[model samples]
Target: MQQPLAPWLEPTLNKLLAQAHEGQLAHALLLPLSKEQGAEVLLNRLLQGLLCLNGNACGQCKSCHLLAAGTHPDAYSIKADGNQIKVDQIRELTSALSKTAQQGGARVAIIWQAEQLNHAAANALLKTLEEPAANCFIVLASAKAGLLPATIRSRCQNVALTQVSKAQSRDWLQNQGVDWNTVGWTYDVLGGPYAMLQQQGQERLEQLQSARKEWSNALAKGQVSATLCQYTQDQPADSLHVLHWLISKKMGSILASQRAFANRLSALISEISQVRQQLAHMPSVNYVALCTRLVLDYQQAAKQ
Candidate 1:
């Protein structure tokens, strides 16, 4: 079920709902891709509104109940099955759209991490986006929209969202009774409280911090390969994200550090980015070995 929109996003929601009410809503709506915003919740809110019977989503209608149960015959979600949204998934969605909605109402599809659509998958989906099905609405949101094909992006109506101010985020967190340090770290690491809490919770703070420090020490000591192999060789999918977040968190400061440090960190970040792309797009990836190899490559490149 979709949660209520945050105060900061209510305006955007209202604007879209207005368009929807007017029958002028685009078949595809591209929400903010930034981590600072919860685009999914916004999209869900819009979908709930569309499904509501009384124009106002009282959370008491049959459609609302179905949505809450995730059995909304008309609503579907497309997200990463493993690491990518494959062509088959897109095809399934298309087929589903071609049929009349089970409830004989609108057809809605939410594409989470739309940027992760593989080339073939994206191409296949592009045709549908360009020539939308009747009463079909697609919502695509991603922090890495830049990675999506220009053509696919062009077909959607963009919903612009600005980052929430720090003061506002702080107040929100305080109201929620989040401790000061977590609020601070969440802001620093994840860009805002909402993203931070979603990405990392209080229970994970200590372990994540320890992991980050160990990786940093390894990076500094030129032990990248060994460090990655030790911690990531068994579960690279999970390990790599933790490692990546740690490195990503420090990249800004690294870029501003001394010349040698900046050069090395830049090289390391590049290697991480390349491997991350491969992990996302390629099938049958040896996640553990790939991460280890990338770390080794980063070490060599960083030395240059």
Candidate 2:
């Protein structure tokens, strides 16, 4: 059985289903979501609802069964190839959309990480977006919708998925039999309930704890540790994010006499942000080197 939608996402799903039933659903929808949101779960429920023969995801109909089994011929998906969605992938999806639905019902297509669509891929999809086939719907999901082409954005109806509040998240986590006190810092660093849940295994928690200790020691000794470098090298983006959070927290506790040190910490945080941006756009960048440089800079900053 499929898991229920997160408390925060249920309303959005219901609204979309209502629109579909009223024949007011747009041909193209753009869903902008943050990393902590459960985009896949919401998308699965939306697809099942849209393709269900009964106009509701009853889960008893043949369409629902096929979707559950991942054999729904009318359902199609496009994903990034490595770091980009190429033109050929878009071409194939368009060709598939042009064909009749194998189940003689609505056809649905989902483009995951839509922001990763390359220039040519975005151009290739415009015709289909403007002239969708009868009973066809296209859904584009992206964390960075601003990276998508203006033409693509203009052609689609926007669907905003809001983040869950901290209080709501804490309540949900408690209901799941988790102790929020243990994972609260992880949640703060990750900034989402789902992200915290996904990343908060005992082993990961230990690694983060160890990294924090090493960071403090490095600051006092004015030298970065091998363990700290390894942690950053293993997951460069996440490590940098954690480091950024740590620096901000440390800055808050600095004495008024340490204003110069706080300023240095602020500069280090900005540098980490820039490195993170580079990693996101250029996956091939030497992350190991970047991690070393960031940790080294932090060590120097601590020397005041």
lDDT minimum window of 10 residues, candidate 2: 283-292
Evaluate model 1: give its TM-score: 0.68
Steric collisions counted per model:
2, 0
Give residue 281's lDDT in candidate 1 (0 to 100): 68
* Candidate 1 error regions (>4 Å): 1-4, 199-201, 208-304
Instruction: Write down the TM-score of every candidate.
Output: 0.68, 0.85
Query: lDDT by residue for model 2 over 30-122, one digit each (tens)?
Result: 987565767777888899999999989888999999998999999999899999999999999999999999888899999999999999999
lDDT at residue 73 of model 1 (Cα atoms):
88
Encode model 1's per-residue lDDT on 153-262: one tens digit a residue.
89999888856777777677666666656446435545466665564455445545655665666656655545455555444444555666666665566666656756
The C-alpha lDDT values of all candidates are 0.72, 0.82
